[model samples]
Target: MRVVLVSLLVVSVTCLPQGAPPTVCQTLMPFHGGGISPQGGIPPYSIIPRRQGGRVAITVTSSLGIPFQGFLLQGRTPRREILGEFDQTTTQDGHTIQCGEPADSLTHNNPGEKNSLDVIWTPPDGYEGPIVFNATIAQSYDTFWVGVESPPVDISRRSVINDPSFNIPRQPPTTTPHYARPIAKQSSTEFDPFYSGCAVTKLCFGAPDNCVINKSCKSAVAVTVSGDRYEFELKADNAAWVGVGLSDDDKMGDDSVIECVTRNNRVDAYMSWTSGPPNSYGAARLSNPQLGIQLLNGSVVDGVLYCKIRRDAYTNVNGKVFDLINEKYNLLIASGSSATASSVSFHDLSFLASAQKQSLSDVSALAAASKLLVRLHGCFMLAAWLGTASVGILLARYYRQTWVGNQLCGKDMWFAWHRTFMILTWALTTVAFVLIFVELKAWSAEKNPHAILGTVTTILCFIQPIGAYFRPHPGTSTRPVFNWLHWLIGNSAHIIAIVTLFFAVRLTKAELPDFVDWILVAYVVVHVISHLVLSVLNCTAEKSSERRVTSFPMKDLGASGRNSGYNDRSPDAPFSNVRKGLLAVYILIIIAIVIALIVITALAPIEETWTTLKSTVMDNN
Candidate 1:
């Protein structure tokens, strides 16, 4: 019986079908797992499983408009040493290459077209069972200033060829393999072929011959003139609304804008209008209905959001679009956080105007000139003139006489300090005027309020030093005329400086952060109070001198002067009781103003409040 049983078992094993092994259906199952997505990525990761030699295709699409720039796919097998994959991703030029090891590492240069990258993965040969595949999607974050990897998304899938019973078809060569394209350098004389539309005749992105003149835009943009249409690429560092506006004037108002806003990992395209003000975007979603504006694609990768916008060179979309042909106009670029997309509170704004076709040399010269102008104007207005002049005035008015009667280097401390401050102010004013001339390139006045005020202030300031040089000797008959001229010119210039500063603050309120208004207001209050105190002191001193002079009898002038100590110019002529009381009041007012400023600055919603001010008064009314 045992011999018969063994013989029957052997026959049964040998009789099994020789064409195919037993099927392990468990090795071929649908992808079923939790809702885990790669780090920094939104979900719905499409993973297609294949039976042939354990191959799988992984595709990740952003739920938001954010484009996928790069990704890392890792396969962990039961046997670590056996882990292997042959991967591929298409480039901008439609060429594909081996994505090796950590998969798609080299393809970072070619970001996905519309926020998606197809990753082909093949597990190691001869290894079967189940393999866990994990991925980390990479894209730009925080204004495209930084790149971050998404958290690992892990899922397990069965291998197809693990059982010989299942047929594993060969994965057809989906794409032809090609060598990687080299990055092209921008050359002034030659246009690089890296850009699609930017041929010799049509300038594209990355081409030096691209005729677009960049003025104040903050993004990496490339604009080209192609026949009846103008094509452009706008790139920024983070996920937000980035756009370009075309205007007949340099101002942002009355312009048509092409915009892309990235949110929830998807980018939305729009055609917007600046019909009224910067805050009023007048945005409308652009879909199949063409208004001469077209969005080729939008993608976000490595913290950068890239949007390709196209429009006819000339269009009459009810005056919504400007002509971009041979005419001169202004091109502006602006970006806002997602929260301010509707309001268009762009944190970044850049502009260039008087744009026309230019030669390479002309473009280079213009670029250098623009840069120099920006730096010079910025330094003069923000630091040199505004900052130094304000400081000098404050020091001369407040600190100069704070140590009255105190001597330094055998000179009156007040006089020495005041002279030093005034000299500094004069030098700063000269430099500021030179910078303004250099920036503007001409002496045309009344162009704007800022220019007019600046010109007047500069003229008044120049007269001060000349008047000082012509000052008459003390006690001379001409001294009173000199005094009056000096006082009138000095006070007039000072008042103009204050007004100019106010106008400057108003003009640049949009550029400044919210808290700057509080700072400016505080300084203005302090400055006015200090000037009042100085005026009152001068009046009181004049009254005291008159009293002393009238009280003296002409016949007994020497005795009266000696008794009243009027001839002394020493430290003993310290502030009187009334002057001391005035000083106390001045100090109290300054302290109170400073405290109030601090409180207001701390509590105010600077940007919002600033917007309200503009809308209520400066902008609308």
Candidate 2:
């Protein structure tokens, strides 16, 4: 008997499960038809007095998944009518009603917490209930102020709450492709029961309610079945914004795994039939249901599980659905265990009819603004670059003319032009940084990535000026070191600046798509060609006089360990070495770009573009 008792004691302790931690989301003051007050009072905009069928419910369970014995849900409005009340013992399939005695056990309570209560209510009556609310759950959401204190963050907020107030727009009378051939089908499957998170179906309206009001009715597969699917046809008088619902998350709460597609204006998704015991089904008893194509104003006449539509909202680009959650959120599931989403397919027949295209002038405000931004910066760059080239060549020509007549280059010439170029560059950079920062400060879902890239680019550009300090005064130790530093900073600045340019293009609203790199490539080409043209013209005209004698001496010109007599007339001039070095740098940059492109291609799925390019290459070959 002692040996058996000892073994049983060990098993009991070992088999005990650890209690779950309390939710980070604190309780929220219940909302009447009105908003919640800070001092725990209901507001005037809340449910009015003596209305019927208005109900709200709150349930507070112990952290250990045990019930608060004897504590029942209880709430009454000023009218003294009970709108909602929690049961002392609520029994579900496997759960027993309050079978344990009422005890305030600190062991199952959150440390340092006060009273634990759930507040559910039906307005005082006569009120239509709250239309929209800015309620704080547990965490702050977006820029919308939840409160000074963080809101109770809801892990999964579920509700069987239904609103009959929606007038769901009737179909617009018109002829469109959506009304043509349509595929709406259903499969033989049962609804799944509700569990932990997500929604489960029940006969909320009762069987006699006649869910369909004399419309096309179909049954489990044929005659008529009162199911959860909503059916309607819209002319797409506007766009469709569909919400996703699922099972297994917090009961009555949202499944965070689903996210809106990038092309919000047009969406496509596959439907599930009996996916993993969906709201009502048994394993091997059902198949994963399939969804036929859906158009903007068409019908899901076939009773499919999912529908596809071309939407009107276009801000969904670049949005990711929970990919970074595992690293950022503790509650996230492992990548291998979670559901793998099948790619959705949608075909919009009325895309052309419902499609939106704007005139150049309509978008000119932004296009003009983008051009102004580039012009605001580019014009300055062109002036500084071409102006410096102009002044330098002009000064060189003037000095050559003077040398032909037996004179030396002027002393103040370099200082004057260099100071002017430096001042102009400084001004352009300052303006660019200030304006770009202001533009990027807003948290726009559509433009945040571009804004971030712009900010980074602006910061890198500031390095160019720091590098310029290396050339404080020419004739320093290896004057060329300053030149090299300046060159490296300049090249890096160009890369970052081009990155900013792309962001700008992405942020600006334009009728036609504009790629920043392509624009930059064009701008740089034009700027360089202009500089080269001016230099060559000046060089050609003054060649004869350039050979004229100068007192600076041939020894100094060739002192850098490379020589070319001042009067040398050969195919390879010494300054030509400077030109060759510049060309080589450009070639190296292109080689780097090619290598980076190859690496990026290998890392990501770029098969679509690669296949097209390969086909073209094959055709050319």
Candidate 3:
């Protein structure tokens, strides 16, 4: 008999606490209304409230497997009259409530496959008004903020507390330690049950509310009213760190990031702030370590990394703070190789439309500006390279003597027209060059072939004018050398400039429709045909010059009342078959250029055009 007594004493010392367990009131019957039936879970079972002494007891219940996270009970009798604050023991599914705080919130310490909680709230001394309870719970994977309000309970019925039917079963002796999880002290970095992490080894709960999945990543987000914190869960298709952030301006700059990374086979979490795009992530700094950025859980499935993170919407940390309660926020998700790295280090990113609306007004403005610049640049390029330059070259090469009798500005007529057209072309081309720089702020030559070619052509054009200014006099002994250099540089520059113009057309096609290409094609055809006509006329004059030198000597030139050159002309002058053949050849060349233009524009490869257009759009984005 003494041995049995000793065994009982030893068991009691090992199991029971030295002090009495916290006491809580029993919940009363007569729940208010029918519970709400939500997706993926049954309706709330019952919400019973009872009073014992100074504390009020409220029990919330739901079916098994319902993902209920927490609840909020607010007094509604006379509005904020006699607030009930949680401070004592609460029970849920035979486990003690772990996440309760000093506020009107009751958060479970551990998540259970089933949902139920018994909470104790203290009312003011001598308070007599009826109290109302407003409860909110996280339904399945933090998917939705489900809520319900209880009818007012009149405290005048004193028998509700003494009735045997309303009595709660006595709590069993404590076998596990229960620690107070006060919110004001939750800033600790050590692991705590209140904000303990969670991981998804498999797709648990089978497609939670507001879940979005693609080939690269899957994600879902939920928020709660306790300091307005957000809980994020992401499953990336690749093994990489996943992150989610909130932005006030829908941009990476001035945003807060919560990330989870797997390094050396160990999963870790980080919080950071950004001031630039993802590529500039090196500038992003780590957030305050005490700011309560917790990685609740993480796992790997089929080479994909899944992570769950929680953080408050507002904090006093040394980073961008998001006011999730008062202001609308934009949510962004990204994946990267390095957990500690900045957002720029990530390879893939997604923006959720539900979090915040994206404004395209700025993008539209930029696109409109780019379109205007491209069209203006294309026009200036065509006018200068094909119209002015082409005409000037042909006139100087073939019609120099033809215009001698009709001089302008104290020079040959063709030279005067050439100078005027070139001046106008130079002015317009320079304007276009400046406009391009304005449109493309960085003037990225590597990305824009048109900008690079334009710069080269502009340089060549600039040097040609400088070279012309230093030309020797026409009658000097060095005049021949000067003319050769002048003509070589001038013609080469024109040819290169024109080639650059062709690429400009291709660039324009990227931004504009195919009809713009047709317009350019027609313009080119007309210019080429005009050049051929000049060539034919030049060849015919050369033949006529030879006849003059052979048919009449320089001694007899003065008697014919004409210059010794081929200026002499009459209706009876002999016409060569070679000249007529050259004219016929020129006509055929013109017809061929026209037909080629028609065929090329009509049958332009749709695939190639589409590829180019897609490239343009991607680059712009």
Candidate 4:
């Protein structure tokens, strides 16, 4: 059995008002397992004296069972590797009891043998602020900042037997620049004393872009009172962000739906908006995560917009133990006036508490990471296209020469390359989507639902290979669907390719390659015209002629099914040549669309698009 000792101490909570934990800790659970205390839990740690050079050690022993089984000491305070993981099952009075792990990080952790800890708090050069400490049981812990409470100083009222001051070096912690405090970077931009929807396009406590501008919202951050919901903006700095869109339609699911915006892939911090749907202004990101005197969890609070920070979404892996992740947040308010207020209130708060102050001073880290993913994803589409196209065009030539599955068709090395390429393409494409999505929202398939149109296109892309691998001898009409699906997916790939290209051009205007756009456009047009002429030739040549022309395995067909069986053909019937030429024309038109998209994305800012879309919608109303 375990012994229990409780002590009550009074404390004040000036920050917490009603419903706060009682002003006194009525139960002081001492760290005792056998007769000795175990090392764990909330502050007031039994600070051991420095043994060698700035290292403090504490011993943990238990007669009944081990404390903190599988354990490791982490974080910046007293970094220590995991001593070891223990699966200690101790028998108490002949009953086997599984005692849990050590948790200097959170409560309910059992420390095994050598439960003692060696901690070293090297405050930056002569620093003296109470080094803050927080423990997260595991990943699912409520992401909240833990407030530092000072340890009782005087011994007259029966402070423990150990001399408290001995724990802290007598040298007096003093420093030039305190690590606890961050020197604010004075921004060069000045806030407009008078707010106008048009003038103040971009906003926030940090660097931001221009907001939408119109009658209702002359700027991206402003909004006019509407018959329905209000609009607002929220931003996150140094963290992954998720937007909570509020809606009245219960059918859509919740009153609020969270849209994940940023990711923690780049480390530092992630942020997202806790923005309710259409409250005032359509939400927007205002700044990147950075150090601030006051932490706002993950939100931006500027009186006009109140964004409170909270913990990142997580899953629990153990009992009562949760790991917390750092996130940033910002809020955009579209009130009638640009008046700021301080009346923000919230219940049940949690956040990833940081005991140290740091900044993402490692320049080029995020940009480089995002750029790498973009390039990687671009390569996936490129590989799929090049791989399939080579086989298709080559087999098309061979088919015209051989009589539909002639002996010489499958006698070459082409079929091997075709299948290999298809397999590789699938893997690459999947990886590309996952990696890019995890880094940033740029070129995201999720942000725009229209992007899935590419999926249908990719399907037709590899279908030919499978059919070729199956029979190597598909009827004329049977091969056409393969051709058609290939065409569709190829076109979709072209669209997605253009988008990724546009992103590259927009980000690195000087480094963009010119040949990509030109080659893509020219090839599209040429292919369409060529397709028409070929269709006509096949038709006029007669059915016997079409049947005679089958070379190679139709090697590129990856997916196939038969219906009246003339393999999926791409021939334009009726006007044949005219239709083919018109298809060429369509290709040219879309090329123009691609250019328009690129120009708008690169030259014109989104603040303008928001305004245009808003105004056009308004005028129609």
Global lDDT scores for all candidate models: 0.45, 0.28, 0.46, 0.29
Tens digits of lDDT, candidate 4, 1-621: 122222111112111111112111112122122122233322221121122122222112111122222222212222222111111111100111111223112222222112222233222233222222222111111111123221111111222233333342111223221121111222311122112222222122111122322222211121111222222233332222323322222111122222222222111122222233223212232243221111221211121122222322332221121222232222221111211121111201101111122111111111100134445555555454433443335334332332223233354233344345456655665675676545443342122333353444344444534544553244544565655555455445545544444334323211234445564565455655655555555455445443432332333343343422234233322333443354456445544544544444332334444665676899999
Badly placed stretches (over 4 Å) of model 4 are: 1-357, 360-368, 390-394, 397-399, 402-434, 437-447, 458-519, 533-621
In model 1, which runs have C-alpha deviations exceeding 4 angstroms? 1-218, 224-230, 275-290, 320-330, 339-343, 347-378, 381-568, 571-621
Lowest lDDT block of 10, candidate 1: 15-24
lDDT of 3 by residue, 1-621 (tens): 999999966653331221112221112111111232333322333344555544566655432223354333344444543254664344532322222223444443433333445566655446665666654443433232333544235444333332343334433334343332211211221211111111211111101112221111133332323335455555554546666556664344566666666665445667767555324333254645426667654554335465556666566445345555466555555554444433335432222222243221111100100134544655566567656666566555544344335668777565687778677667767887876665444443223366666787787677767777786554456655655665677777676775665555444223233454555566566666666665555555547665432222223323322242223333222333433454356445444543443343332333334444575788899
TM-score of each: 0.39, 0.28, 0.37, 0.29
Error of 4 at 587 (Å): 18
* Residue 376 lDDT, candidate 1, scale 0-100: 42
Give the worst 10-residue stretch by lDDT in candidate 3. 360-369
Better of 3 and 4 by lDDT: 3
- The better candidate by TM-score, 1 or 3, is 1
Model 2, CA-based lDDT: 0.28
Error of 3 at 156 (Å): 54
How many clashing residue pairs are found in candidate 4? 98
Using alpha carbons, what is the TM-score of model 2? 0.28
Query: Any runs in candidate 2 off by more than 4 Å, and if so which?
Result: 1-418, 442-457, 469-472, 495-503, 506-522, 535-543, 546-621
Count of clashes in candidate 3: 6
